[model samples]
Target: MTELVSTTPGLYPLPDWAKQDLSDLKGHQKHDLISGDEGPEIVDVYDRAREEVVSEQVDAGLDRIVEGQLRWDDMLAHPLTVHENVETGGIVRYYDNNNFYRDPQVKGELTFSGDVAAELDATSELLDDEALQAVLPGPYTLAELATNEYYDDDAAFLDAVGEFLAGEVDAFPEHETLFLLEPSLVTDAPDEDLDERVPDAIDRIVDATDADVVVQSYWGALEEKVYAHLMDANVDALGFDFVAGDRDQTLYNINEYGTKDDIALGLVNGQNTLVESPETVHERVEWTLDRIANKSFDRAYVTTNTELFYLPENRATEKLTALAEIANIPEVKA
Candidate 1:
């Protein structure tokens, strides 16, 4: 395992290339909109679109980070193939695809090609000493993509889809830990048994993939049972969105979860562009660090909860570069 270093805790921002990619693709992105009731079309993907976006992210040379993202042309959907069945893939009429989004659910092949994996591998190679992290849309999110799949039973599809989706990760080529984004899981569904299935689906993914895993949840606080189940997953890290979740502080104790495992302290805001100051960032970081007695990181980290996807490209780069500088900064002795 290649040793990776920490940015230590400072105000580093999103990568510069992110803004460039946004600019270069904004028009294209704007055109991709299908406008789901939940939000805009920024989340959609354009078949092979990642080829260019990932290329630019790697070229940006923003070490210690991955691109904000490249997925479903619809707004945030990925791994979804285009099809007439809305559950699998439906034309929302807001987005355009080279035909990828035309089919929302993934098609025949459950695996990625060496060519696709090679591109990811190239990005990972650029990480230098840092572990390359990538995001895999969470099972529930994938279930959302199934909105079009029109399955007779949603839960069953979630299970079958979970099994299939796990294969995608088993096939995806990358290092570092991969994040399974489950923002929707932050809250529960009154109708379904999320308590048992959600984490179970994640386990299926874990059992399927070879890389270290990070189960990330945002938007709302996770239920005690859900958090407890995640603790048992033995994942490399757990990511939470402090800004959106907004507890009264000392959130960890509320659930009786200790600092025994890895946790990504997501302090930055992905929805706002206020550009938090370095000192403030440092303070928050040090506060979190103190909680663990500066305990040499049982895999600790700070994250930008969601992507600054809405922010313009230039500003995004400035933020990312600042973050890299902070991460690479040398510790000063008192």
Candidate 2:
């Protein structure tokens, strides 16, 4: 029997309290204040924001819950950017979207910091009995996003990043699911050499954890070769951006390179302002499952294609409600 799970990709939008200017602090100063002892008010804002996100997910009957990544000011790059040896520099476009993250300038050897783990712990404490899932940037994506000055080559850099991320995975508390967000794998499209190296790095990061790891890519469907490579990766599941990507190509890839692991169908559009109806979402999910009936999958996760932060809080909540409704449909589950 398949499990009906509804979840977000992390990084929910900031609440009104979080967006307010606190005493005119600027740039890194603001970040420092929130992360430092001088910012209890800012910390309270994030705490309340996370509580709100968790409450909504539970109310919507989602099977899994996330920390909402309320403190990820730099999106997926936050963990790396805040490292002691890394410096935040000029802004860079985050994937194909209007969002931006400061480029991470690596000044020395990369090491795992416990910031992400601490955030997860705080959020996990807030959850009643619900299973908490942690989200982190994938190794290859982080390697591509940062400017490396200490590594000898791309291969070495990827290895270091992979090891660093594995340490982060080790630091996480007992979690039911862990999502390694890898949008760069699709948006940047690594060359043949890096393509071969990426899966190795992914394996290193995933092998360190026993939790079910889902390597989720968004913005678009992966190139044929990359798609095929990920199908054979050591991860437990592969998530496709069906909402923003080519649905036909995604289904073709799944058929061509069959998977034994679960498939997370990104049925909700996280980037768009329009909220899809329950009927439309249920039909699309069934349509994909019907085409892949011959393949063996342990389960299917119905989720948004990307981070819900792109949409307003109201639309994001509505989208989650629709996903929950669709997942519970008897025909869709059957």
Candidate 3:
């Protein structure tokens, strides 16, 4: 069996120069490459200055990191739109040009599937020198964000997107890394007496992938039952957002995971300019290692809770480097 590898999640936004390139993506307009305020930019990572940032992250010591999610905002801008199983343009909104619309009141085209797959190919090539963990916004997240024109609830939205995404994942295994950003999946499941409707949605989405699926939860930790189910799910990894969440003891629950499953301890802050120190990271890694070892987990990783789009360039670099080193860190014994 292939060993469960480690990696940081994607979207550590680009630096000043790279950011400038993104801010200037006006003509020859990139879409879907990165999500943006309105409509996704389909630009290839190799073609943009942001590619340089991705390359730099790999050089900075990330055993497996992203191409810096150079074009996610652009992709989010255009998001996937599906209407009655047909294609339309897309639903777009503007937040001073930063793409912040997740109104499930309208339906649009769900055509980024091919585009997403293509870019993953490009992403794979961009990281040809180092291992990469490709990021895909979870179907649940995307569905919740969808502008549902005719759909009744978030469930319908997620199911469609899940099927589309499953097809996307089937296209490659070279990514070697796939982190599904479901920041709310675990925190939102309903109690056993009630029907949450989300865990099943998550299951459908994860069941379709050949790639190692990392069910990532940030923002908050739901009831204990929520995470327990997630741990026992068929996914290959569970990402705990230690940076933004209050999920400390969840690390000790590691024994519930499958042999191939991994634990991603998100220690780096991704939404701010505050650069975390390596020593602090080392200390945290020590604690995390102890917890996982107790649970008999041999594979674990570290990354930022969210994308680094909010962090300054230098800080992002330092945190990612520390994470890389931490991944190579030896396992602590009892």
Q: Cα lDDT of all candidates, in order?
A: 0.51, 0.81, 0.57
Q: Candidate 1 or 3, higher lDDT? A: 3
What TM-score fits each model? Answer: 0.69, 0.93, 0.76
Weakest ten-residue segment in model 2 by summed lDDT: 29-38
TM-score of 3: 0.76
lDDT of 3 at 222: 45
Q: Candidate 2: where are CA atoms >4 Å away?
A: 21-38, 331-334
**Tens digit of per-residue lDDT, candidate 1, span 226-247:** 6665566556667766777555
lDDT of 3 by residue, 159-218 (tens): 666766676666644666678887545445544633245556556657656556777777
| Candidate 3 residue runs with Cα over 4 Å from true position | 1-6, 22-46, 74-112, 186-196, 248-261, 292-294, 327-329
Q: What are the per-residue Cα lDDT tens digits for candidate 2 across 171-202?
A: 88888988888999888888887788888888
Strongest candidate by lDDT: 2
lDDT of 1: 0.51
Where's the lowest-lDDT run of ten residues in candidate 1? 1-10
RMSD of each: 7.4, 2.2, 5.1
Task: Give the poorly placed runs of model 1, Cα more than 4 Å off.
Answer: 1-63, 82-130, 148-152, 187-192, 249-255, 291-297, 328-334
TM-score-best of 1 and 2 = 2
